[model samples]
Target: MPLRLPPLPALRFFEAAGRHQSFKLAAAELNVTPSAISHGIVGLEQALGVELFVREPRGISLTASGADYLSYVSEAFSLIAIGTQRLPNHRADRPIALSCAPTFASRWLLPRLAGFRARWPNVNVSVDTSHRQVGFPVDGFDFAIRLSRAPVAGTAWTRLFGERFVPVCSPAYLETLRDGHGNADLRRATLIHVNAASEDWQAWLDATGIEGFDTTGGLRVDTIQLAFEAAGMGLGVALGRRPLVDPDLDRGALVEADPATIASTTAYWLVSAENGDRRPELADFKRWLVSEAEHLETHADASGQTVRAAVS
Candidate 1:
């Protein structure tokens, strides 16, 4: 007997709309018009004799029936992905294309990637150190690591870690700034700033309630990695974001100039296609990445006097 079901295209439209909770976003992802998505979903609802969404002024949300149906539809798609992956012509050796910021690619990911390789020797990752946002599948990227305050729209997001920006400098440089109280006196010290993250210094200072520290003038560099390099050379104090700076701190190449830290409003997140982790390789990578992040958080400095700052 032939399968009795809704039209495949209508199912596809319904799945995308349900996943995103917005007809507009669904249209964007599917490369169609919002009207087309709405019409398709409406047709599907009519065929099933059910209302799939609770349309509101601000947005649309899945109804109870819609939510239940979505699970089955999502599972069907996952099976399709897995089946396609297992096909004879499928290239198992193909690299998993990834996009991320250059600084993160160098200072953080590169250092830890060797372990990922060891665990999944056949699974290769091609890292694209591009700062620009990329469209998934269309851009040929399987995953992306991004720093943002919230999850990127139209993709599945797994938060890697929250960020804490701390003041760091060479031990020798720090020694030169100590006052009679044996505390690092930043008011007399040169402030190093990353041109892209000029607000870090001010955020740290505000969070610490430190007065008389001038952020108006200092060594300005293009990247956080460069700023750290300058600080390591005993140039001046730089605000180093956590996890990225964790390795340096462990190596004693840099020390916290002050005990206070600003918990940034932003964090690092791993993004992929919706339901992308259904692939066994992607699932493994996601698990490994989360575990690595958890390990870092477990061993991170607990002694720092933390102050929340909405650092961009």
Candidate 2:
């Protein structure tokens, strides 16, 4: 059966009014007068045989039916926008869409992006750094770096690198403690914690069997990057991942407190649609990602050995 569709102008008018609950605001957005917006919305309501909005003297409010319909309409428009933007001819000069966790993108990928750009100067790369999982077919992302223990189902997955977790502090913070390389040493310093992973500090304590430590002291942050920053400012000792803190460790902004690091159950996974085999750009990206992961793995192994040696 053919789908009956409302006029684009009417739908646009209704969507704008539903969003802002003000015809004046809708008119401003549409670059028309309030009466024009009202006319369009009224026409839309008549065509649908329902009162979409209740007009109050001060403003407007959605009826129950209008609220429900507005949700679907808003979603439909969002999907339409995504579809139009992702269309081959409609897209900007950049052709690749890469989704990543914000922390990973900021701490690791951003630093190394110049290398990828140097190699693929013509291929445009678009990065999405939302924490939400990207739905391959629905979200239309070509590739993603997901921080997870397992690969996403229904997609081709490549393991990136296992993350190592350890206690880290700024040089000045550590100098104050003076003691090095034990669970006991950490107890004397202020401890920074990431609130998102509530169990991380407990897990570290359980693994190391450290005593007399107050896990709840100092600053509590919502993100690993923020925790690291706080620790770097001599706020406290932060439990950090090697990938996110490696550059800091190299630059002397932070130093690992213990050689005994915990291997995170979760690791970064490189994911793409199984059907991504058809696109040349997708294929190139997957190959590049695997090579990059291999490089990271090698460096991680060497770093682990160095830490072990230093601790011994």
Candidate 3:
């Protein structure tokens, strides 16, 4: 008898949902809705004639069957990625194509790219920025930097840095709020928001639990780099993550608006294809990248003594 198989699309959804342990997160990875993931998984369960998840009131958990099946599916995907990466065209001299989040590409990596180029003059690299997670090996990108509190989809998930948030603005902008303490006069100032990310003024505000100011009243930009740029130009106060703002702080172009910092559980992960370890340039890149992140201050509060200012 011929072997039975679930629909390929359903299998893919099941794998993603199982790996993340959340339909919502799985939907994010697959760029679909949670309902779609649920439907797909339901379809798969019907096809397999088994319960794959133990659905609870709050969230879903994988059944023993689902966990066992996921291990196999994940391994198969890894094997495919490894095989593709080992092809003849993936030569040592081929320029390492790195994909990254747009903000990270502009603010973090590109600024430090000169160091990498100088260290490996003979090697070449091309950087592509995307908000979506691309398929490893199939996307033709050798590596990618993912910003998340959890592991990103792919094989090698080496952590590069943990994230922390602080509000930053030009020195001139800070002067405007000199008499203002806390959210008092600061509420009237323009706010800069990175629309693509969740690390917004609202998130920072939530973490700090400082009330009264409107978190939504700000200039919204598509990327975090633009947020910093606007803040540096005194356009508004931007919630700056440590990984991207440390350079600005060091140069005196920007300063902390508040001394309090919101430490992010998510960090940057260096994700790559399954065969990334076997690649020639990966070792060099990882070593240099790790060293740079190690030097970034995760706990330093640069903004002067934090104080409560009245919402004047």
TM-score of each: 0.68, 0.68, 0.66
Per-residue CA lDDT of candidate 3, range 118-165, in tens? 999887888887555566654467788887777755477878876678
Runs of candidate 2 with Cα error greater than 4 angstroms are: 1-93, 179-184, 304-312
lDDT, candidates in the order shown: 0.82, 0.77, 0.78
Provide the lowest-lDDT 10-residue window in model 1: 130-139
How well does candidate 1 match the true structure in TM-score terms? 0.68
Clashing pairs in 1: none
Candidate 1 local lDDT, residue 223: 88
Q: Write the residue-wise lDDT of candidate 1 on 1-312 in tens digits.
A: 998989889998988888778899888767999999999999999999999999999999999999999988876876676567658757767788889988899878888999999999989889998555565444456789988888967689999887788889998999999988997787777888887763578777767677887688999898888999999999999898887887889899999988777788778899987776655787888899889988877666454545566534
Candidate 1's C-alpha runs over 4 A off are: 1-88, 301-312
Candidate 3 residue spans exceeding 4 A from truth: 1-81, 87-90, 180-184, 297-312
Candidate 2 per-residue C-alpha lDDT over 1-312 given as tens digits, one digit per residue, 9 for 90 to 100: 999998888998888888878898777766899999999989999999999999988889999999999888877876675566557765445568889877888887778778877887888778888555454444567788877767766688889886777899897787777655523367678888888763466666666666778776668888888988998999888887877888899899998876667767677888876665455656776787778879988877775453321110
Rank by lDDT (best first): 1, 3, 2
Q: Candidate 2: TM-score? A: 0.68
Per-model RMSD to reference: 8.2, 7.3, 7.1
Best by lDDT: 1
lDDT against true structure, model 2: 0.77
